[model samples]
Target: MINETELIEQLKRGDDTAFRTIVEQWQDMVYNTILGIVQNETEAEDLAQDVFIKVFEKIGTFKGDSKFSTWLYRIATTTALDHLRSRKRKKRSGFLQSLSGSGGEEKEQIPDFHHPGVSLDNKERAAVLFKAIDELPDNQKAAYTLHKLEGLSYRDVSEVLNTSVSAVESLMSRANQNLRKQLEEYYNKHYR
Candidate 1:
């Protein structure tokens, strides 16, 4: 295995092979981080590619103040959140257009999303869980996704989010409470 320092140095020097190696080493991690946030395979895949492209373009800005993975996670999280915001904006605009009768487009229906990381037996439950996760505030959602779905430690999540560990802990606590409320509502409606 190439030393991470050497690989990064080569990447900084614009070595194509080093860039390829870095992508190969971190692609799955990047993809999974994005997938957990976006909760859609195609968008996650596309966002993962965008993350790498940003990495290549912005590698010079990496000051080595934090672990490379921390920086990469920050990039992934930001990119995914930006895409979500853009989607929300487009949806809102579409809604307004329909209200004004300028848009002949029918209402768009998002299908139930299933994360591939979920097992077959738990797919339905996982889908419900992800929907609740989607309702969390952005900070809580990012903290929860990093710490729970991506298996990152609270401290690691804090670094990626550029916040204190205590903030991450608080976010996780709020996220859990919100998710419980959302899930309970879902179950009450369907199973009660």
Candidate 2:
């Protein structure tokens, strides 16, 4: 139950108990942030573990200019984005190999994602929304996830994203437009 400053100080001194406390406190937030981006439970779990490891190793680098949670959010988003990029690269290579007739693996597809935070009655709609989210560019996706999903304020999201508040606002506006277009398309295709 120590204050965050004390906990951070203990962590910097390599106190195992403090590390455990920090993980216990922030694990859910970290996991949920990653899950919003990656949209796969298994990958989100693995990336959450990786986020904690990064926190443990990089605790000294935390400057305390922003809230600890904001720093952690930055790490989680960066890790998830990196994993997504790596996955895309692998898929591209696999596609090239298939084109060359040296590999026969089928193209990978993004599965429908159900965010745990969604209510049971909304799971179907949430899955459709998440699929559209997955199509957004990375910055827009991160801004939308942090602001809309994680309930961060525009300024806090700007801090996590290392950008200006206006930039976050711009990202959000574009995200909303894109999501509306995508959802409208889905509606037309499925219900028309």
Candidate 3:
């Protein structure tokens, strides 16, 4: 296998085949990153494509300071985040979701349709839970999603969030406390 530096060199030289190679190499990781953010496979696919288009357009500026994969993941994360923010703006502006979500912080009973997980049932509660989560402050939701849902380590989460690791920890702590209170209220209302 050629080293990543060689791949970057080939890509910099403007070889279309090298670009295809980069796509084939990174698509799964790219797709997974977007899925973790949007929780929608269809949207994830489009976002991943957008990331690649960005990578192609900006490859010449890739400074070579970071590993290519790391650089790519950063691009993926930013693209996914931009897409998420756009969706949030749309949602709040009265766009009805075609597919439903539980909207709470508690893991939904059924496995994520796009991810493998322990099987469970009765996702309506999760939808209600998500509604509560959606009501949270933006920082809290972002901390919870990056730490809990994405399972990124504190350092990684900090890097993605552009905060110190201790700050990430504090944010996650507050997020958990807020989610617990919200979920408890949710449980009493529906499960009591």
Candidate 4:
């Protein structure tokens, strides 16, 4: 198999095979990262696919300033956030059509993720955690997901999120505090 630099060079020259190579190499990371954002099997799949599509479409614009994975993830995060915003806009529009006392209810159901490790039952809990993540501000959500979920170093996360290392740390700290508060509420409601 060709190495990343050769693959990228081919991709820059508009080679479809090279694009596929990049996708095959990094699709798992893209999927997992998108899953962390969208949290639905189908939506995550579509978003992951969409990231590759965008990469292929825009490969010429890539100037090789960073690792390919980092660039791909930046695209994935922006796409997922765009998806979230569109969904929210749709919900808002639907709410406007609802009768009085019906405007406050949301149709989206955030699942529960009580387990962080590998447990079959933890899928539901993981879903819950993802929902809480979606609720966070973009910076906090990006920092938390990049560092905690994606297992990137703080420096890597800062690069991905386009912030300083210190800013990333603070974002993560606030994210953790916010997550703790949200998870505690969930626990109290369900297990207490």
Ranking by lDDT: 2, 1, 4, 3
Q: Count clashing pairs, candidate 3.
A: 7
lDDT of 3 by residue, 42-71 (tens): 888999999999998899999887567667
- lDDT of candidate model 2 versus the reference: 0.93
Off by over 4 Å in 4: 100-117
- Expressed as tens digits, the lDDT of each residue in 123-184 for candidate 4 is 77676677678779877887787777689999988878777899998998899899889989
Q: Better model by lDDT, 1 or 2?
A: 2
Worst 10 residues of 2 by lDDT: 103-112
lDDT measured at residue 29 in model 1 versus the true structure, 0 to 100: 93
Better of 2 and 4 by lDDT: 2
**What is the C-alpha local distance difference test score of each model?**
0.92, 0.93, 0.72, 0.80
| Residue 104, candidate 4: alpha-carbon lDDT | 54
Clashes per candidate (backbone, < 3 Å): 0, 0, 7, 6
For candidate 1, the per-residue lDDT at 67 reads 98
Off by over 4 Å in 1: 104-106
Tens digit per residue, CA lDDT, model 1, 79-111: 999999998898899899999999747978777
Stretches of model 2 off by over 4 angstroms after superposition? none
Name the top lDDT candidate.
Answer: 2
